[model samples]
Target: MEKNNLYPVFLKTAQLEILIVGGGFVAEEKLHFLTKSSPDAQITLVAPLIREGTAEKAKAFQVHLVRASYHAGYLQGKHLVIACTDKPQVNEKIYQDCRLRNILVNVADNPPLCDFYMGGIVTKGHVKIAISTNGKSPTTAKRLRQFFEEILPEDISWMVENLNRFRKTLKGDFESKVHKMNEVTQHLITNKN
Candidate 1:
């Protein structure tokens, strides 16, 4: 059997228990997206002093705020960890801890310590597109995301909902259901104009 590399898995971190080691703007930005996707996600923000904006947002969203510096123990049992602190040593320590625990870790703007890069995501209902360059150029990824965000129609959610209903109503084998779904999707896209 071939060994599987986790870097290639396009995972949905929506329900994951995530630990963010920072309370600055960077950490708040990350939290903003995470909470938007999954309001119920268990997020623990660890920092010595929480910025007002970060503290207020955390309080509003009921996020767990741990007022302390980065420690190896803080990484325990966390499915995903993010190091957004300005201190290079603290970020490095978190990365090493993640490696030891086999947990996924991303150090903000530090490609060397990042196990996986967080891409710009555009989600329309059930359909989602994640744009990434494997840390080559983040600006390019943001541009692509903006383009997709503009082009993707807002009515895509209606199409997805109808397709899901069709799937539920159909009683057939896997291949037949897939064929029917493709037909529905084609019809929806064509008539959407």
Candidate 2:
């Protein structure tokens, strides 16, 4: 059976430098979702001609914009990169450069050249969920994200905060504390009717 081998991880984008090489719709979409999830993320965008809308969005997130073509020099100090340029050759070159520098790179719409896929993310107060479709079906991941957004209660974060406070007040060994907490929260999944 086919399976997704991608390991999911949450990143602290604010602490890492990210670069996006493009100024088109794909680049805008990536920037939008990334900023929506991590408003403080430090990002730099390099494109010869940037759209007005793209420039406005970049300003909203304080993204550094360079009105020039992408080059290997832009990869300096960058931890992650997304290549979505209209020119396929340019995007491929970006991917190759990143590989040479041991940096993670994602070539938009090209799974074979990507080291990571930018999956759909849904965020509430302190709760966030990411959905991936193995880079096969992005539409499926979007649908799942919408479904989760609708089903999850708005106050889910409140419950999590309360649980955290309760956990801090517990007095017992590690195992005993875990057992007690599990018992306390068991009703969440158990049918009481």
Candidate 3:
């Protein structure tokens, strides 16, 4: 049997059910990213106890918090699961359960057990850049994220919105008049300066 390698996947599980199996800082950080990216997602957090600030934030954000120990049954019907507990055994169990259930799972600090890896992401409207080191070095990913943050134009959001509008307007003709559309977009972007 071929072993599955860890890689980054662009998931469109927005507004879907996501289960988080931890309550510490790591779990909170994952939740923060998910909420920021997909605010409408129904998030269910399963943990015996959550850290102080996390509980308040979960309450404020309306995330469902289930106070319970790690169990394989919790993996059922979840679109995705994140194991952020410090306990290696717990993380491994969650990963195994997710694998059995065909659900995507990310185990904090354990790349080997993860089905998908989270990359450093920078988003401006519909434009997004994701940086990953393939779990070799997170520091490299962070540095790349910093570089993108500095280099990405602040007007990216406006550009993205304009491009979206242009695409909608062009519609089915976009395939035949690609160059003309690009030229028009470039003209618009340049004129915005």
Please give each candidate's TM-score.
0.85, 0.97, 0.83
Q: Pairing residues by index, what is the TM-score of model 2?
A: 0.97
Q: lDDT per residue, candidate 3, 35-70, as tens digits? A: 776676788898998998778767767898999998
Best by TM-score: 2
| 71-113: candidate 2 lDDT, tens digit per residue | 8999999999999999999999999999999999999999999
Ranked candidates, highest TM-score first: 2, 1, 3
lDDT of 1 by residue, 1-193 (tens): 5442435454555557889999999999888877765667788999998899999888877789999877888887799999999898889988988999999899999988988887777877777787777787888988998899899998888877877787999988999989987886686458654
Off by over 4 Å in 3: 1-9, 171-174, 182-193
- Residue 22 of model 2 has an lDDT of 98
Ranking by lDDT: 2, 1, 3
Clash count, candidate 1 = 0
TM-score, cand. 1 vs. native? 0.85
